[model samples]
Target: MKGQIMDKKIIVLLSGCILAVFLLAGCGNDEVSSEYNIEYLNKDKTKIVDVPYEPEASDTDGMIKEFLAKLSSDSDNVEYRKPIPNGVEVTDYSLDGVMLSIHFDADYSSMTEVEEVLCRAAVVLTMTQIPGVDCVSFYVADAPLTDIRGNIVGSMNQDSFIENPGEQINSIQCTTLKLYFANETGDGLVEETRSDVYYSSNVSMEKLIMEQLLEGPQTEGAKSAIPAGTKLINVSVVDGVCYVSLDENFKNQDYQVNEAVVIYSIVDSLTELSTISKVQISVNGDTSGTYRDNFKLSDMYDRNLDYVVSLEETGVTEEE
Candidate 1:
């Protein structure tokens, strides 16, 4: 009886030891699987780490912060002879299902605060068109975003079409109008990049005191009109304007423009698209030595302007 009692005690103790070992093994296995699911890219191979949930965008804030940190480091080495100007910095982001709202600052250029809001909309439209995302929004320098008219902006409701006039001239007003279309349409609207900048904002409201602004040429559209051989060599932007350098094309070929044409091209493009108050024109990279003296794009030079040229005959005909 004493031997049997001793055997029974030994069996009970062995069972408790086995139960403890099994519990520990189960807990360890759960942790290992959790770690494997949370993988990361370290230049090449994936590194696994333990995580608590199925990582969504909410779980991605820390990851994005780390990614941007590395991007900022890489950008430090980028050199600039003319200095590649930086736009507003994207500081924070909000994502609700398919819509992504980014927060940014716009003090880099003195253009306008409305640009920050519109620029982000361009980014959002590009992103939302992807399979998962459907729309995007922005906050300017931590404040709510408004349009050129100071109205609140948001994602388009029901699809809409945005129009393009094709290669006309290079005016910020024109480009900005196109940008507005993209924001309104939620898609890209570049008809043809050309090599001609116009000098007017016919659509803009006029002012007494104006700063002469220049516009970018229609780089792609001018291909058909320009000599078949010209190609774009370099492009530059300063103070919210684009400056393009072409490797010499058909300079002798003439299209007509009068003072009215010149003034209309510059001011119309500006006042229509932006709140800009003035404009100027340059051919190739140099200002025309005789632009304002007398109009000279052939017949285009003879038309009368409302302010500069009186409607009364200044030699420009109705057809001219």
Candidate 2:
């Protein structure tokens, strides 16, 4: 009986030691994990945007794992098409200057086309947010990973995903655009010269500039005359006349700005492009849609810089 009691006591003591070790390890791991911001596609999948997340580990692999785990879990606001598969794992990672190379388990080799793109977009956008990381490449079983189009070409940055926006990769070429935005008082428009990236391959430069106008200005003292949630449906040019189609969001307004300011904002901005001489606005595909300001949507407008207010005089801009 004495021997049996001693053995039982020894077994209990060993189990207690193991449990303590596990608790300590878990505590240490928690301390090593940290929080940071990462960009993910919005729920509508319309834009590559940023949000905050607490990761499981502070190291590169750990941060990635936590990001992938959150992507699969849908605990955040963003949309992710393929969750990290059950058997897939990040085996190793290396950061050499701006490039990040991540090796995964064999399961990574079997992702579907859509899954591959979404997964790659998620990884690249999230990892590149790291201070020194600019590009990302993947590997499976020591082999270069395949992309959405099944190309084995290596290395991808923000521009690699430009053909698909909200994937948020910008392969942008810088160009100057003379865009008009609301001055500080919202009473008049202001001319702001913006050096922005050229992002569209399917549309004309004039149309892209109009879309940027709808995206609003990046300048501090400027405000967008376009209504919030407004989307550019289509833009076409014929004989120097640019026809712009916007969604129904354009018809509605919550804030009071001079109606002429809004109209001339579009006109002056697009006419700055050499290909465009005039602009005709449309709402929800209807050329006849007119606002209360008596400006007919059907009218072809020429540039009217008369309404542009000098930023030096107003000394005011919209508050973010």
Candidate 3:
């Protein structure tokens, strides 16, 4: 009986130990699999762009906090620069429906107009990329944001930043075109200005932008997003959407950049034209499909400036 009692006690202890191990394993597996692609401003501060990062926390709030930490200017990644001014920090954040409210310390009130707009743009672009989050609202110590128009913005979406037209000059000899190209790593897009691109009465600004993009980047560290020999078949604008049709060679090219890089490179470059708000791509007249099965081309894509990589994120300071 004594030996039987000892054996029973051993079995009970082993059972408890097994249960504890299983519980620990379950906890270890709880981390979320989703990665957040956060946006930051480029080196010249002309464009905002994104870089991918995996948040360490499993909960929504924790994931956002982890993202804010990366955006705090203390992160190790060279490509994760923060638009939020130095000494500014996200005190807290919350989500309701499609809106996210971020509360900052009092220091946030000190940012200049451009600084505040860019900072808010970065946060909204970064957070909205996450599933189920569409809009963002800013707060400082529970006070809401008031626009220059005197109306409090309930929330701001991507549409809040519309492309305002710059001064346009029409001359008989030549015209300038603005184009966006992929960075060397193919992780971001860089804006390149083609000031003296020769164009006649037959050449449209839309055509010139695509032609310049296909010609590839002039800057050393920038790269061409379009594949070689990809000819632009036609471009037209109906309503607010720009229809871009390319040749069959556009589909089977050997460009190694991310699909987002390739798609946005074209979409973003053309959308720089204030006349276009969205773009639809077609390969060999087939608008019902996608490019390389990566993304559906049938759907119209707005200029995803968020996919452009920030030059600030690409450089490491000497102190690091």
**What is the number of residue pairs that collide in model 2?**
4
Model 3 over residues 1-320: C-alpha lDDT tens digits? 12221121100001111121110111122453324555555453433544545666766667676667666663344433477869787888888886888889989878855566667766765666555567789888788877543447578765444222121211123455677887777777876676655432235678778877877877656788887778889988889798999998787655567778889999998898899999999997679877776879898999888876555564522121
The list of candidate 2 runs beyond 4 A from truth reads 1-172, 317-320
lDDT (C-alpha, whole model) for all candidates: 0.31, 0.63, 0.65
Query: Which residue segments of model 1 deviate by more than 4 Å?
Result: 1-87, 106-118, 156-161, 164-320
Top candidate (lDDT): 3
Lowest summed lDDT across 10 adjacent residues in model 3 is found at: 9-18
Per candidate, the number of residue pairs that clash is: 38, 4, 3
Residue-wise C-alpha lDDT for candidate 1, range 1-320, written one tens digit per residue: 12221121100001111111110112233553322121111111111111112223333445344333322232221220101114536677776876666666665234333333223322432233333344556566876666543557665311211122232221122222311011111111112222222212222222211111222233221112222243344333345343333334524332433333333433343334343433343446554454445633222211122333221223322221
Of models 1 and 3, which has the larger TM-score? 3
Lowest lDDT 10-residue stretch of candidate 2: 9-18
TM-score, model 1 to reference:
0.26
RMSD of each: 25.4, 21.4, 22.1
